[model samples]
Target chain A: MADRRPRKDAARNRAAVLAAADPLFARCAHPDDVTMADIAAAAGVGKGTLFRAFGDRTGLIRALYEARLEPVRARVEEGPPPLGPGSPPRRRVLALLDAVLCFKLDNRHLAVALEQTGDASPYRTDHYERWHALLKELLEQVPGGADADFTAHALLAATRADLVAHLADGAGLSREDMRSRLAEFAARTLGTED
Target chain B: MADRRPRKDAARNRAAVLAAADPLFARCAHPDDVTMADIAAAAGVGKGTLFRAFGDRTGLIRALYEARLEPVRARVEEGPPPLGPGSPPRRRVLALLDAVLCFKLDNRHLAVALEQTGDASPYRTDHYERWHALLKELLEQVPGGADADFTAHALLAATRADLVAHLADGAGLSREDMRSRLAEFAARTLGTED
Candidate 1:
């Protein structure tokens, strides 16, 4: 499979480009400030090679979004008790808040970059749908009196990245404090009967 | 009193500029996508006059931020019980969620732009700090532990504009659903004994 060598190299180049672009886009306050050449330079390749690898900036961004899902899913599956499967629905809800907050805080730069990329892309839409589905499943496991879907939407809204970043960086609030408040808010909203 | 006439005209021009810029900036996916010329056209003023009034793009954005605050405060104070001052802390908390969600939904464009601006400006920093203080006061009244400040910060983090947008627009969750979930989450986080 000597012919496959270039194909494998292309794959490596794509990954390397994404890895470098993630932080650069995330940390910048404005996405427009980043150029294709910048991304190519950061990826350690020529500008032409960068264009060939991702086709365009939007394609590169989409790849970044796709790459993030794996870690996010793994974190949801095996990171911690409340965030993972072992804890009760109530505790898991709280854990999810913490996990999301932590993720945003850790990747604040990349998170903002992706959001600023414009609304034409389906990346964010798909990501949130998946998150909403997972949250809905958790709500179903809780008290079953009211509409779980609506409740799940509200909970997700309250824990958005902009809100998280505002509290953590803008408002100077600590992670633990943010988690506790959200946990309390979730428990009451979910009718935990505590 | 002739000098007063020019000053009054300037004030009116400034107001018109801010009003026009708010909607244009808000509706745009990227704030930079909005140029000074677009704002001037929206304001129905001469392009030169727009530049003379606001000085530049950043100055216009700052004015927009400040101008919106008065309306927000009024809504928070004069709106219905849960959002206003008349209801129980619990209901008030829910009302706050409703108020915020409605604001974001109605002004989705502006909300997204302002959030992307981040805390680069002193005005943004102060605006966020005030909200955290207000949240802290509400949490302190809830009879929880002395860690009310922390709790308030956490709730704020979860309820910022980006997160709300992510849930509503990006995630395709309805406003009503988000409100209900946040209300429950707030109740539990506040240590509701019920």
Candidate 2:
């Protein structure tokens, strides 16, 4: 298809492209194995469409990551107590971390691919800055939140996709156990542990 | 120049290669610039010797990382107070983390090369395992030590090479500030804060 299109059709094509890329990333043993050509063929779109849609492979992986993250991000942003703004600071911190951990666990392969590609540091991304800011802000609200910035980074570091994958795949740690341990670890940092 | 050299000369040549490669990696804008041939020429040896000793670029990097880490590893295992075996658990934990962070700061370029190459997960390395085990042991001695294992991993994750580079290169955080921040973060996790 040409770059020009009806808005609705453009949106539909973008959705199709993302949807097509998801499982292809999930099933591939390596991220580089899934190319724009593969995504285009799977989505029944031309290679030009995939490029025009996502700019390139990194952009596509990033879009898919952001799309998959939308639901959880929304919940953390506006859902309810615990994850949303309404919860007490400590509880909110834990909830935000749990949400990040869960997201990584649920999308391990995609997360790994997106992280390991583009010769870019995952720390340099906008979403990373956003999450770090949110966590740092929430930590600031806690009583002993003096080192909120560093503490936030430390907490997020624990949930890094590669770490999660190592724990899950190499260490044989169950997801539930991983979550529980992370929650407990965060609690220690927040000074809220029993 | 050949692999069949007497063991003493081989030892001398191996040390010479690591010595020559150190400044090259430290000075280069990119790690790839410090090639095996470069090390060979700098070490006054043949390229065949460099390959015979270290296998390839990734192998050379890994060897350098381990070689550089030997002193700090020794201090943690049996040296004096703080990082040594005799410090209090909380203090020892802080010391170990500081040591790791300082090492990364001191070896930024080489560390990045070792991590970026090989496509290996850093978590699976024997040294990482050793560090985790050591941290877990120290955390186990802290008052609320129930989650020592997870806490050890979380704490170490904060010092990951890429994150260290991000803080140093992009964020432009001063080394002292980074050290202070990490110390404070570890203090929080160790439950030693006021």
Candidate 3:
């Protein structure tokens, strides 16, 4: 009973920390401004608890990002037509990219913070590999005879967090406009444009 | 003659620094490891002169990149068909993307170094604006009626330095293979595949 209690408490604390960190990241003027101390304070936990739950600031940011992305991941994994397993390859491809673009648009700050965390290439992450693999698999099922591997990378690059932020913030592209543009680009790549 | 001598010396020092820095960046294990002191030492100039000439590490790297890119810029500006102004719009788009991919591939470390500097989004650079503007203008002239502005950004994103580095270094994509993939992707985007 005692051992189980600590495990439950750990899980609850993790949830609290992620929930508290999300809005802090979203509202900060710069990602660097949102520190572990700030997140710990907001979560009403000690700084040691924050460090224990997530190893560092980057770790906490990544956890918060993943938590926010969970719903989108679920939709793509097992939801309805156009995003899940039930749709045509071309439609799924467009939907997947649009989902990525929309997600980045919605979580612009967190996404940028995660990508900009360190010297490591963003492409090295398991998250990137998963997306690239899924996209490549879908592109192979499409009719274009494109190089699915490179095509997947090119398609995802179009929705890179920094690029999305640039379009959204610097160029002032509306969410609908960015999504439409990505859909058009993906359709042309798949040779399925109407 | 006395005033001209100092100007001539500065110009000579600038060229020497770039020449010395080129191989250093190419051979470094990591970009941050090659400091301004290393560059000044290689060029036989004082560190103060290096800083005075280029402002900082980012500025020096940018200048060196611009120097190396001169041949490409000149070719695209006025040299010949395909890369130059005389080629058909679709062909020029293909050529322009190819040039960017090849340039990134050839100068992988230096390009990555310049892009990785500090907190700046690479989209804000004047260098990027020039390429995007040129590509957008060319895409507008193409017959497919694609959204030239967004399409230009998407196409250029495919050849981003870190993406090129990831493909070249991490994925082990050969130079020729990378070039071919970019060409194919650009052709499909421009709707000019034969």
Candidate 4:
């Protein structure tokens, strides 16, 4: 048990280091500009420990991406109503958009960084597919039995980051306004008169 | 008058060169890979004439973009029906979307190239602002008057090539299906109950 405790502590430290580094990298103008020493200092771990934990810069970046997406994955899997299960499909779709919008706005830096790196992060593809599937399932539950796959694609396209950024930054639309409009759109597409 | 006819011929040839190269470059794997020589060959003009018409590679690219957008601009300015004058705002909005979708789907390569090139081109900013304005104007014309800017952002986001690619490639949604759902979503966001 004592030996197991040390291994667990090491794992916790590794996670903490990655978590701290993830946002920093995301917010940086260029991820390559960040140094391992800076990350170690921020994580409160020795530089040697940082290298030992992740092996190299590429490894660290991969770990950071995974750490960033874990909560997002869990939220979609089992968080609560709107984002989770139990809510109507229309509401769930709206909630998903809300969550995604908030996440993108709050973590714009990291999102931009991840996008710039061009790594095939599974989170993006997996989350998108999951959202589409969920939307499709919900659409099927509608009174008129709408086309789930088509509806899902439309909903997903309307919530993309580039489109959102164009709206928020380019068109000067407020976050609340965007959210409301999206919700209304979702409701209509799902065949809910209300 | 005879000299003026020569000038008119030059203008016609220039227009032809732009039209032919724009679609070809858009579909090509890399814009840089296609040279002035290639464009001239494709346009059935001498390389020297092509160079004289557009100063350099950058100039040629700009011309291509301008040529592609000209029809859209003309429609917005002087066309008729849903995308032009003498129609309800609701119908015009749908028409504008139909035009854009068709253009995008047909020139997907150009769309992808523009997006991948980032914000280096001055045309990007200008077009973005113009599209936003157009969307806002259409939205304001809605019977009850909704948030035009927000609706614009959501609608623009729904039409991005990345999202279209994702739906077509990742989710296997057909083009027809995506278009219908998007139209339905757009109608709802515009506040038409039907």
Candidate 5:
């Protein structure tokens, strides 16, 4: 293993770190409690390798979160009708929000970890801007869309990690119930009031 | 000053601590960066006194924030018109969101400091529950209100401290612009299509 090609060994090391880190994050009560040493030990790689591969704990969490979210992002960006640009603005907005909610729901621990990073604001993240911009653009196409920017932000705020965590754990709402409630709320928000 | 009555001196020290802490929080780039030691020195009080008065850093931030927000709370709880309970539900909801947003704008530093505390979920705060319950009740009174509970949370989420700080500082939006945008968005939300 030590004598393997550089590219091949690095790729193997990267995969090993992610594989080891995912379950630790999932099982931890607090994400920050999972540390560099833990990931390095679990991955069976040197601490130096961990540092070289991911800049820091935050970087590793971000990578893990992004990796977990990739499938959903792919679907939203290009998969089809509702999430893709093909659907009507109203439907697309709902799809986008639901996708975001489901992503947070599915990755609660990762989301919480990413959100709780010391100096990182979720708003400053590349994906947050992408999601917000996509939603804002869709919102502009809706009939009464003057405040698309703020509305886009407000809708996304509903799916924020801590809020989702609170509703899921503190409020004890079932996952399905939370999803349906969010969908209903978004529909009302995006639709002409009934 | 040292020889004053215990009750009077305690009151003076408490007031001094809050007064000193306020500017330090406002001037610092990050809220948590301002230490209790820093505040104690600024207030000319012993570290013991600062802790005794507020319990902890989180306690101090909460007290200062509550103190700053008292006027707005008073208007909502007792004063007349849109913010008061006497107003129509639809109008009251808009007023409440506006008032919350304005308060965040007016006290950005304090809000950020209060929010960055550890082990404290913003959802668990007394003020948050009070505001949520009030908004939920008012929302139920508004026509076309189906999911009033979730709707209330969603609306309030729009005014989260970090988001406000980001928009104010990162987005560089003026206070009036933010208020109007929020008002317009909430009106659309509470109204039967703008």
Candidate 6:
């Protein structure tokens, strides 16, 4: 029991740092404005703890992004209709994209921060591969003669964080507007439009 | 005659620098590996001339990209049907995307470097706006009731430089395969497929 104390503390500290970092990233005018020191100060942990936990700013941002993405990931993994297993592939594809768009809309700052990390290719991430693989699998099951592999990439590209930011922030598209536009676009691409 | 000589020399130097830089960017394992010094040495010009002509690395890259894109731009602007002004909007759209895809495929390293510049949003570039606007205009002319604005963006997103690099370099797709797949994807999105 005594030996487990440090492990428990480490977990708590990580959660605390993530919790503290989330709102800081969300509220910042720019992602670069929120630094390690800010996160450590906000989390009530030492800067050493913050760096030790995440290695660097990019690492911290990645973890925070994943943490924030947990709910959506869980819903897709096991929750009910439109997102989880058992739904029609066509409907699931639309749902998945809509969910992704909404998630980006909701986490605009974080998404931009993660993408702006310079060294990370959005295409190279584990998160991207998981989404791409699932979307590609579903696309292959659709009845249309669309090339599933390329179509999957094209469809996912429509919801890229940078594109979403351009539409939402730069173009002033409301959430509902962006959602409907993406749905229509995806449906057309999928040949599933009614 | 003396005044004109300096202008001619500057023009010659600029052309030489672009000629030298083009092959270097295309051949380098990474864009960062091909620096201004290397370009100047290859062009047989002073590094000062390189900076004076293009400002810095990003400026130089932008100029080189524009210079390379010039022939493509000319073809679309006035050359002939399919990519130019008189073809059916549907066919023209397909041709336009194919041209963009091929250009990215040919200029993979340059495209990647330009995209990886970190601060420049691809969406914000004049080059992107021109392509998007032309694409949007063509989509509006197509028979489908698709949202021209969003559909144009979605279509263009498919041919983004990084996405192209991922397909060509990372995914090991050949140029022919990518072009056909993109053409098919665009056709499906436009509802112009047979």
Candidate number achieving the greatest TM-score relative to the actual structure: 5
| Candidate 4: regions farther than 4 A off | A1-66, A115-124, A166-178, B1-63, B120-124, B168-177, B192-194
- Write candidate 4's Cα lDDT for A138-172 as tens digits: 77777764466766666666665555655566557
TM-score for each of the candidates? 0.74, 0.86, 0.89, 0.71, 0.90, 0.88
Native contact share for candidate 5: 0.49
Worst 10 residues of 5 chain A by lDDT: A185-194
Q: In DockQ terms, which candidate is top?
A: 3
The residue pairs in collision within model 4 are B82-B92
lDDT value, residue B170 of candidate 3: 90
How close to the true structure is residue B131 of candidate 1, measured as C-alpha lDDT? 65
By TM-score, rank the candidates, best first.
5, 3, 6, 2, 1, 4
Q: Go through the candidates in order and give each one's DockQ.
A: 0.24, 0.58, 0.62, 0.22, 0.55, 0.59
In candidate 6, which residue ranges exceed 4 Å CA deviation?
A1-13, A28-49, B1-13, B29-50
Cα-based RMSD of candidate 5: 4.0
Error of 6 at B130 (Å): 0.5
lDDT of 6 by residue, A39-157 (tens): 99999999999999899888999998888898999999899988999999999999999999999988888888887676656788888889999999999898855788898899888
- Decide which is better by lDDT, 2 or 6: 6
lDDT of 2 by residue, A1-194 (tens): 66676588778999999888899988976677887889899999999988887888888899999989989988888898889888889988888999999999999988888777635778888789999999999989988675787788888999998889889988899999999999888887777545
> Candidate 4: what lDDT?
0.67
Against the correct fold, how does model 3 do in TM-score?
Answer: 0.89
Worst 10 residues of 2 chain A by lDDT: A1-10
Pick the winner on DockQ between candidates 3 and 5: 3
Question: lDDT tens string, model 1, B66-148?
Answer: 56666876767676666667777755665665566666666666655665553352225656677667666766666543366
The CAPRI category of model 3 is medium
